[model samples]
Target chain A: MLHRIEPRSGVAFTLKRGQRLKVSDPEGEQVADLLAFNADDVDEVISSGRTLDYASRIFLTTGDPLYSNRSNVMLRLEEDRVGRHDFLLTPCSADTFRIIYGDEHPHRGCFGNLAAALAPFGIGPDRIPIAFNVFMNVTVDGATGELKVEPPRSRAGDYTVFAAEMDLIIGLTACSALQSNNYAFKPIHYEILD
Target chain B: MLHRIEPRSGVAFTLKRGQRLKVSDPEGEQVADLLAFNADDVDEVISSGRTLDYASRIFLTTGDPLYSNRSNVMLRLEEDRVGRHDFLLTPCSADTFRIIYGDEHPHRGCFGNLAAALAPFGIGPDRIPIAFNVFMNVTVDGATGELKVEPPRSRAGDYTVFAAEMDLIIGLTACSALQSNNYAFKPIHYEILD
Candidate 1:
């Protein structure tokens, strides 16, 4: 199934075991905040710490295992064209906007979009996990050790593919940081293949 | 109980919820590889992805939530002095060494120490996840998004405290990158508070 996630919006679906979820930057330089949970429990979603720990690498490359906190393998990086998908940084949230930009800006971030999409599943702000910022460019300076978030390195039509190790509920957002220059600020194209 | 982790060695312990685990760099510039698994499952372990996601930030700070992949809250940052702990990059591994430094240069990485420590728990290399590189310095250049793993900015006696959310098995290692100047190349001081 293929879907189009409009800007500032999100979509949610289940990715069964062995199926691959492909999120593409069809026009390039866009970012998608990806969040996932176990289809059955929903509580046991992907843990960035565990995935990084188990993979033993910071950057997600092909063959990297995305492990859940329960030590359960959830997904595997089967393919990646850009090889720079971000698993370290966090997605922008409404609380973040409220805190950083003030309360005037409320419904303009992933926090709201994810909450709305997962609302049917009974997930709220407390349960909404930070997402994997796909197609986002980030760099850590070697000398100063400063982290800089930038635009995506992906060219048009660039995409990353992951195989589900178990059934999953994958959620995505067309990044809500619309006014920021750090991300692509474009729409996202997503698909799931059995 | 307080324990001193020797240089190039690692230790494993169980932490119950509300218990705080403190790791300190007594002499400064040392890195501790923190790995945790659910005490009951072991398969579901600490996730860098989840911790960063739930906390909604890239860096760990006091009061940040450390979440498991099950979207379960596993730990919390109760206290922090040098707030530069890295949950983004992964620890140095042996396979990574062999690929970069050749197989002849054996026993010079965190992989062996972590593997040895967790072997008793039936965790093999295939199961070892990338560890949380605590007290380690990682800077991503904002302009270039270039990630630089650097030396610690932490002073001597600096420590970070984390409270357990669930019963967990924590593994700590004194980094084995003997030739690198990027990390604290020393022993780690750890203690558990009730």
Candidate 2:
């Protein structure tokens, strides 16, 4: 069963292993990031590592430490809940925009926004790796086994915190509009510390 | 450069080209979609085109039509800014999670909760797509050319609406967490209609 995080001081803090975070949205989905770091901060993000990606708001784990093309540590994971929830995957790309939106829109290569944000670090579409999603839930059709995005089981103040083993750059965004699955949107909070 | 969408009425509405939307999160970001349909159905998503991925909570633009993925018809657009000031974005995936967080922690193959949510879709480690950062803001340094994630430029009651040209699935999450940033975690509200 899913659980909500209750900070000891009545205020939510960062997440740690063996901790549970909960969230509740009015009618839509609620998303949040547990932690994130820069890839270039560590010696090497070995495979079978773990960390959080703030941009996609999901937890990540790897079998090998991720290395930036610049030879910097991209990320490493300590723990994960991918089997439990629909952790985030990869960021939407400009190519996705073309495929989903069509070619008639004003913005031709809209993925440029995300690329621009990562450009300073020399990160690009080809270099962008998969992301992780934490806490959020996605229901699967038991019969067909098809996956569907579901309302999160998390409530307000529910959180998870992780310790950073390396330097990293984290990016997160609270979704703005989700009319596709009804107005099932909710608010979420996050916290991180040393 | 960006604008806001304000409906004259309180009921949920649609938006067309040349419209605007606004948000008020103090340092919040807003994302909007353009649809092709104008029916009173919840699952009437058309094309998920023309996304206002990173608009400040103060004011945004919705004059452009979000394109469609499968159909040719463009969804009409409308505007209605009601309810609390909440914007959202869905998390990404595991490989991405690794790229961003692996260096900070120690674990591998951990996709966190997002993987669980997407598992049902057969969207394995290889199928995840890059996500869109709807409302978060990041600035790039001019002289040093460094990218910095910063506060948003929006406020409450500002919104942008679009018409669905085809059936689309919209994803969102309200974010106000300040674990990595300087702002305090706040809640945001959102609404949608035909």
Candidate 3:
């Protein structure tokens, strides 16, 4: 069945029995599709030496074959409560790490986190893909053509689940605490129900 | 006077006054330029409201034209501690926001921050620019050609400072939260020095 999160928000497509979702973030834009997987699939992937971790409300899933370089399924939603937030693009690079944390330690940065997520598979900084900031609401300046960032319309606890149609690697960071606005230094929780 | 930050592991350059510093990602895909400016010039841009704020680490001086987008400068390095960090590139989107403060409210994402920063100028999501993840150390997998994230080798207080040779609006965030991984959330500070 297909579900909608808000009256005018993004749309969500649920997988039915015997249906499979093919997802991909082609162009590294950070967008994904949907699918339904059981614990066995999750265990099988992990047993193959993959890792999935979470922080605060964000979940980072990493593995092989769920997605490919040229064209691959980035993520598949298994379940979703906040459909709009489910496909929200990953946060942009600059804004992700510093906003959460203060400027106490400028030396320590997110480059490492990004590297760790991709390095295991032999991916390097040059090949890092452009991610989609799914579910996040952004606006642009009409006259000046400037981009603006803002809090999403969705609230906390809202989520979407998907099954991997291909092997994929996703990374999540709670975000540091340095922003003058928005949440700072609060712990968010997430779970992977295979 | 000009300065240079030698790469601890790779090539480094020594910069002289009026000499420009151009830095690219490790793989040499993306690049950014940096020029030295006096405190007076930096302050003029700030006083003119061309740039938003300044950090103490940066210095502004006269005789330098704060370039703008089309006709205005997007960013101005009003201060600097050259050699501490190279003006290689801008921060990542998520890290940019985290440096601003999304960690406290783990549930709240960086989108709001992006909005807040852009709202003043009437910019919106549609206008949000495709930002570059500067100075981040990402690795590409040799086998699968996948990108990975990693912690930066930059030390505490190591910063990448530069003037907006062109008027370009920028969004920044500090990433790297344990909530995302095992990396502890660290604070990042910003100063608008004149």
Clashes of each: 46, 167, 181
> Can you write out model 1's per-residue Cα lDDT over B47-121, one digit (the tens) per residue?
664455445456767887776545466778888888886766445665445544566766646767887888888
lDDT of 3 by residue, B1-194 (tens): 32222221111122233323323222221212122122222211111111111121111232233332112343434343322221112222243334334454342222334445445544443222222223334332322323334444444444544444432333333333222111444433333222
Model 1 per-residue lDDT tens digits across residues A75-152? 888999987877775566654565545668576577678778887876655455446778766555444444455677
Clash count in backbone of candidate 3: 181
The whole-model lDDT of each prediction reads 0.71, 0.32, 0.29
Better of 1 and 2 by lDDT: 1
Q: What ranges in model 2 sit over 4 Å off?
A: A1-28, A33-38, A41-84, A93-114, A141-145, A176-188, B1-194
**If candidate 3 were superposed on the true structure by all CA atoms, what would the RMSD be?**
19.6
What fraction of the native alpha-carbon contacts across the interface, defined at 8 angstroms, is recovered by model 2?
Answer: 0.01
Candidate 3 chain B lowest-lDDT run of ten: B44-53
- Displacement of residue A88 (Cα, Å) in model 1 is 3.0
In the order shown, the chain A TM-scores of the predictions are: 0.90, 0.49, 0.46
Give the winner by TM-score: 1 or 3. Answer: 1
Give the top-scoring candidate (lDDT): 1
| Model with the higher TM-score, candidate 2 or 3 | 2
Candidate with top TM-score is 1
